[model samples]
Target: MTLPTLTIGNKNYSSWSMRPWLALRWADIRFEEQIIPLGPRGLGPNPDILAVSPTGTVPVLELASGERIWDSVSICEWAHEQAPEAKLWPEVSIARALARSAVAEMHSGFSALRKALPMNIKRVKRDHSISAETQVQIDRFDALLQSLITRFGGGQASWIFGHPTIVDAFFAPIATRVRTYNVKVSAPVEAWCQTVFSDSAFRAWEAAARKETWIITETDEA
Candidate 1:
């Protein structure tokens, strides 16, 4: 059977790209990827992609059946439909609602963090201080992490949903931000970052991101 094709941007800075990519990899869904390097303007040419997603945004999923899934959350939702057994969301109804809420919050919110500490997984700097806006976002993230731990974490699990679900995918970009910006986070969040970075597929994506030839002016090396 033909799988869907996922279009994305430079993994180094595209937080949106990280979401569905992580879910797809975790679900073991075999799909092709088309990396359109994000420029300073944060867009590129791909008439087909633009036709499917008018915004010309990255992380657009083109299914083999000619169905289009734009937006990161939509892509994850589609993935869940394609791989129901993957448990991308929690099993419990309430928990599932909360999970979807959290992921949606990440998708529509966090403007400060996105503007201040954009994802740059390959850049290893000595000092990584966050801005005031970034700190606010980090604080919200801390609260979210604590709530998740209180609700579904613990035991042998390393993620929010007691298992690696789309919630984890939602925050994977934050893991890179925390590391890249050196945000002072609690031990739980720090440990969670380790778990995310340690994932083989995440590492593979990061590796490819680092080797990418296109560089956005806004994300020039420091």
Candidate 2:
């Protein structure tokens, strides 16, 4: 059988691509990957990407049946659908609702933090300064993480909702950003970041990212 294809950009710089990629990997779904190099500084309008992606972006999932799904979160949702047994979201109704909320917030909000600290998995900038708006978002994220951990963490599980889920996959990229920029975070948040870093799937992706020679100069400067 032909496997589904995930079209992605540079692993070193594409956080959006990383999200659904992690979801699929962690869910143990098999898929092929096609990498289309992004334009300089990661600016796009690339005909190659545009040909396959409706949004002219990376991280599009093309199924064997010829269905195409775009956007990181959308692709993640598709992964969940493909493997419901993976339990990508929390099984508990309330917990699942909260998990979806967290993923959606990460999807739509956090613009300031994203703008200030773009993900560059191969690079680390210790003691990097962030803008006031970025700090506000970081503080908000910290509070959200703390709240989730306290309510659902059950002491032993490091991931939000007490186990790895779509929530973990969605936030994996942000965790990389925190480490990349050496952003100060609370102990619980830091522990969660460690969990993300230590994940085998994430490690595989990071290893590939480090090996990639493509450089988006704009994110490299960040």
Candidate 3:
């Protein structure tokens, strides 16, 4: 089968792109990747990316048949459809439903946290401030992780669903964001975040990020 092509942005800071990228890599799905450079003058919607994706965004998944999916959530669902054995969704119906809902929340509910803590893999701000509203969201995130870990996690498993799934990919950026901006969380959330941060795919992305030439100067300074 011809590999699908995934167009991404800087691994150093494109948190949205990291979602489906991590899902594809972790699933062991063979695919091609095109990294579009992003910086002060190169931020999207770049013409190059706009030429390929209708949304003019990164993380567009182009299938061998030429079908293109632009949103991270949709791309993830499509990948899950193509590889059910990858266990991208929980097998149990109820768990899967909750997982879907949680990821949806992550997609739409954390604007304040996101604005205050843009992801920058190259920088670690140990003293960054979290506004009260952002802190509430962060606390909500920790509670969500805690709920899942206590409800579904088993021995030695670090993923929220007791295994890697779409939810992990959805939340992967938040994990990186927390580390980059010194956001505090409960021990369980911290542990879960570490599990995500340590993922082979995430680490691989991090290594590449460290080597990328593109720099978003403001993000680099915390």
Candidate 4:
């Protein structure tokens, strides 16, 4: 059977797109990919894309059944349904809820961190000190991770559930952000980021992101 196709923005910088893309890939789900560059004056919308994603957003998921999933979280759910054996969520009930909460928090919170550490996979490394607002968000994120790891007995696992779950996908961008901005963080969080960056799947995504030519003006931090 033909698998669904995932449309995403530049791999290097599109945090939203990376969430589902990573989850799907890490799960070993077979699918095709379409890359959209988001920077200013990049490739305009394609006629084919305009038909699938009305908002013209990258990271739209097109199911084999011809259904369109526009948002990243929704795509995560869709993947879960398609590959139930993948165990994309936590197996335990409480861990599942906590995982969902973490994912949702990442979905809605951290505006400052998002603004300060816009993903640019190829950009030269440098520390942009966290702003007061960004620091607050960072602290909250740190507390959340610390608590989860403490509860779950962390080691090489991707997230609180002790495996790669939707929560990991949600925060993968934040992992990139923390490293990109060189934000001061506890050892555990830093270790988590290290694990994420070193993952082969993430490295593949980064490679593709660096190859993208699109340059959305809005995301240019330099």
Model 3 stretches astray by more than 4 angstroms? 42-44, 155-157
Each prediction's RMSD over C-alphas, in Å, is 2.3, 1.5, 1.7, 2.6
Candidate No. with top lDDT = 2
How many angstroms is residue 170 displaced in model 4 relative to the true structure, after the best TM-score fit? 0.7
Residues 70-119, candidate 4, lDDT per residue (tens digit)?
99899998788877777888788998898889888888888877887787
Point out the higher-scoring one by lDDT: 1 or 4: 1
Clashing residue pairs for model 2? none
Number of colliding residue pairs in each model: 0, 0, 0, 8
lDDT of 3 by residue, 47-133 (tens): 888888898878899999999999999989988888899999899999899999899999988888887899888887898877899
Q: What lDDT would each prediction earn against the true structure?
A: 0.82, 0.88, 0.86, 0.79
Give the Cα error of residue 192 in candidate 4, in Å: 0.9
Query: What C-alpha lDDT, on a 0 to 100 scale, does residue 46 get in candidate 3?
Result: 77
- Whichever of 1 and 2 has more TM-score, that candidate is 2
Residues 1-222, candidate 1: write the lDDT tens digits: 987889888888888998999999988899998877676543566565576576778789989988888889888988888888999998999989888888888888998887777788777665866677778888999889768866688723377777679999999998887887677888878878888888888899889888877766566543
How far in Å is the alpha carbon of 70 misplaced in model 1? 1.1
| Candidate order (TM-score) | 2, 3, 1, 4
C-alpha positional error of residue 150 in candidate 2 after TM-score superposition, expressed in Å:
1.6
